[model samples]
Target: MPAGVRVTLRTDSSSLVCRYQADPAPTLNGPGERARIDVVCDGRRADTVKLETHGGDAGFRCEGLPGRMAAPGH
Candidate 1:
């Protein structure tokens, strides 16, 4: 995927989860790092996700609830 690329999905689900991997990341940390990933539903803030990264090379997950995404002008 290129930078600034937007993706959309159309569905009728009350909740959804997105998971992805970042190759060549950092190692797993002992205490880990604290971060928050926001979930947007219908162009609005729907939920906030708590993330703990053990290392640079790790998996990032994002989730949303009761949201729908489709290609623009669809």
Candidate 2:
């Protein structure tokens, strides 16, 4: 993911899934830095995903999310 990029998803399911391919050698601003994505659901901070590589393509599942529509907040 890039800076200032936001993706909104609307679904009635109680969980959210993600699959991504990493750039194994992504540029970083400092040594030992890692990319991260913040997950916000229903206007609250839910989780943070660290883009750690595990050989090749990887994925994650966020379960038990509220199954409703609501605006996100800062």
Candidate 3:
């Protein structure tokens, strides 16, 4: 990791966010290898959130949905 090579992602309200420290010597297309720190946040239906990443390999993807909303009462 290098100084000033950090990635940060936040929501419009700035309530939900993520931060990642960049790795200078990153390995791509390898097993158990990561170039960036991975972070996730869920609004749980109360709000909508977006994700972003930086300072790592050019190829990276984040996928998944937030927790399901609770049924009417329980």
**Candidate 2 residue spans exceeding 4 A from truth:** 22-25, 54-59, 71-74
Per-candidate total of colliding backbone pairs: 8, 0, 0
Candidate 1 shows a clash count of: 8
Clash list (residue pairs), candidate 1 = 14-66, 25-56, 25-57, 26-56, 26-57, 27-55, 28-54, 29-54
Candidate 2 lDDT score relative to the true structure = 0.70
Off by over 4 Å in 3: 3-6, 11-32, 42-57, 67-74
Across residues 31-53, which tens digit of lDDT does each residue of candidate 1 receive?
76444556555676667665444
Q: In terms of lDDT, which candidate is stronger, 1 or 2?
A: 2
Candidate 2, clashing residue pairs? none
Candidate 2, residue 10: how far the Cα is off, in Å: 0.3
lDDT per model vs. reference: 0.53, 0.70, 0.40
Q: Estimate each model's TM-score.
A: 0.46, 0.61, 0.26
lDDT winner between 1 and 3, please give it: 1
- List model 2 lDDT by residue over 1-74, tens digit each: 36887888877678788877766644467677667777788767787877655666656667777777665452
Ranking by TM-score: 2, 1, 3
